[model samples]
Target: MPYIPLEDHLPGITGLLEYSKDTAAPIRELTQTLLRGPSTLTEGERELIATIVSHRNQCTFCVTAHTAAADILLGEEETSTKVKQDISTAPVSDKMKALLTIASLAQESGKSVTPESVQKAKDAGATDIEIHDTVLIAALFCLYNRYVDGLSTVTPTDPAFYKGLGERLKNNGYNRLPEGYEHLKK
Candidate 1:
């Protein structure tokens, strides 16, 4: 059971959102803008940043959720699995590795992202906006990870469930709810 009683059958952050819609709206909006918004980084790349940070933070729900998102966006489950296994050696571009480094540091402490880290990202062709967004996504996930874990929310163990949600998220985009998710709202 959740640490706080939430509506029945909702999982992970969805449960918390159902418990509190006022808080959920802004979080959803921020996620929509950060992960779904247009940018030099592909939606997959941004979701990769979230996956990396969530994994580093040891937030299982966030990691699983974002990894599913990344998998759908990248159109290959292996790509995200490789990155999750080892970002430095993953098949992604050099720029992505450098950005993941910055995200890792942000997971530890924002102050750990030194000028050198910024320089490395720049060297790898990461623009100012890309760097800025990477840091934001990393930092935002720290908050999200803590929120989900802190609440002791339910996390489904079924892999197929996540894969299905991933496809739903990719098709619908974060601005609108997926077909069955209407029940999540107040």
Candidate 2:
């Protein structure tokens, strides 16, 4: 059960968003722009950043949801698993690894991000925008992880739910909750 009442059908951040559409709008918009918007980083790479941050934060719902999204966008499940297990050994390109390192540092703390890590990413071909986005995404997801877990939102155990969510995220991005979930806002 959530710390506060929430829709039974909706889980994780969905429930929290439904609890307040006013707040959800900007959150959704920013998430859509960052993850789905045009950038050199693929959606898969961005989702991997989210997954790793959620994993580090121990936010179960986010970890599962983004892992599924990463798997779908990247066309492989193992990449997420490997990243969660160890980014150094993950099969992503050198640029991705460097970006991920920066993301990880951001997860630890904004100040934890170092010049060396930024340099490493640039050396691996990460643009100024890529470096900027990686840190922002990491920071955003940290807030998200805390928001979801802090409220004690529903976290479904069913793998099928996450798989479907992954597909929806891959196709729809985060612009809005899917139809039928809007009733809660009334």
Candidate 3:
């Protein structure tokens, strides 16, 4: 059960977003711009940043959703799983690993991100835009993780559900809710 009353069938952030379109509208746009919009980082890379931060925060809902999205974008879920398990040894490029390190520190505390982290990302071939976006994505997920977990939202236990959600998010993008989002509306 959610900390606040929400539609019984709607889970996680879906219900929370639907509960107030006023807030959801802007949040939706922000996500669309951050995760779906054009960027030097591939969609998979951006989603990976989000997934890492969510994992650091111990927010199961955000982690599950973003992990699926990252996997869908990357064409393989295992790679993302490996990165989450150990970014240093993951099959991703050195630049990605460097960016992930920055994301991890951002998840801990924005101030924890140091000049060295930025320089390491640059050394790994990450551009200024990539570094900036990685930090933003990491900080954004921290807010999202808190939003989902703080409300005690209902998290789906089934992997298939998250997989399906990943497809929906990838195909439809976050500019608007998925087809079934209407069910949560008053």
Candidate 4:
């Protein structure tokens, strides 16, 4: 049910990378590296940014995936209540909320992110690199959210799917599709 034909679905973020396969592939490869790479933002903080943006965009696939990612990073005790809460005030660091603020603003209106927000993040001790990466992560997920929703792909609410997927998503990412996923492309 994608806007394009089924055969066109390359799975993962393949479609998004199609335009810049030569350039975009490297960017994506870099992004994936950054995803699991070292940064001031903890993996949980990064996952929270993704989950917040996913929820705002109403991208169920991303929401579920990142939610699971958050769960795996934070553990069941911390993530339990967060499952039903707004990410802004969820039991995460203040720096995380700032990133979510930036991400949510980016989602609602790209221009909505004010200098004040960036300053606030800075005041909160978020380094320049942290702020930069937060913006990149937000922007990337916007594309990812659209890709999933645009595809008309099936999305289930079961938490277990995400739970099991956290390790792989945190590690390999969109490169390795889930089991039986390759078949969907055909």
Q: Which residue pairs collide, candidate 4?
A: none
Model 4 TM-score? 0.77
Candidate 2: tens digits of C-alpha lDDT, residues 1-186: 799998887889988887899999999999999999999999999999999999999999999999999999988888999999889999999999999989999999999999999999999999999998999999999999999999999898999989999998998889775574756443
- Name the regions of candidate 4 deviating beyond 4 angstroms: 5-24, 77-84, 177-186
lDDT of 3 by residue, 1-186 (tens): 789998777799888887887998988888899888989899998999999899989999999999999999999988889888999999989999999999999999989999998899999999988898899889888889999999999998999989988998899888665465665344
Worst 10 contiguous positions by lDDT, candidate 1: 176-185
Write one digit per residue (lDDT tens) for candidate 4, span 1-186: 455544353433444455335766666666566577777677777887787788888887778778777777777646524633775657766776777788788887778999999998888788889988888888888887887787665565566656666776766664534352455343
Query: Whole-model lDDT, candidate 3?
Result: 0.89
Q: What are the lDDT figures for the candidates, one per model? A: 0.86, 0.92, 0.89, 0.70
> How do the predictions measure up, each by TM-score?
0.92, 0.96, 0.94, 0.77
Q: Per-residue alpha-carbon lDDT of model 1 for 1-186, expressed as tens digits?
A: 679998666788777876787888888898889888889899999989999999998988889988998887888888788888898889999999999999999999989999999999999999999999999999999999999999888888999868876876787766546454665444
Q: Which ten residues in a row have the lowest lDDT in candidate 2?
A: 177-186
The candidate maximizing TM-score is 2
Model 1 scores a TM of 0.92
Deviating ranges (above 4 Å) for candidate 3: 178-180, 183-186
Q: Best candidate, lDDT-wise?
A: 2
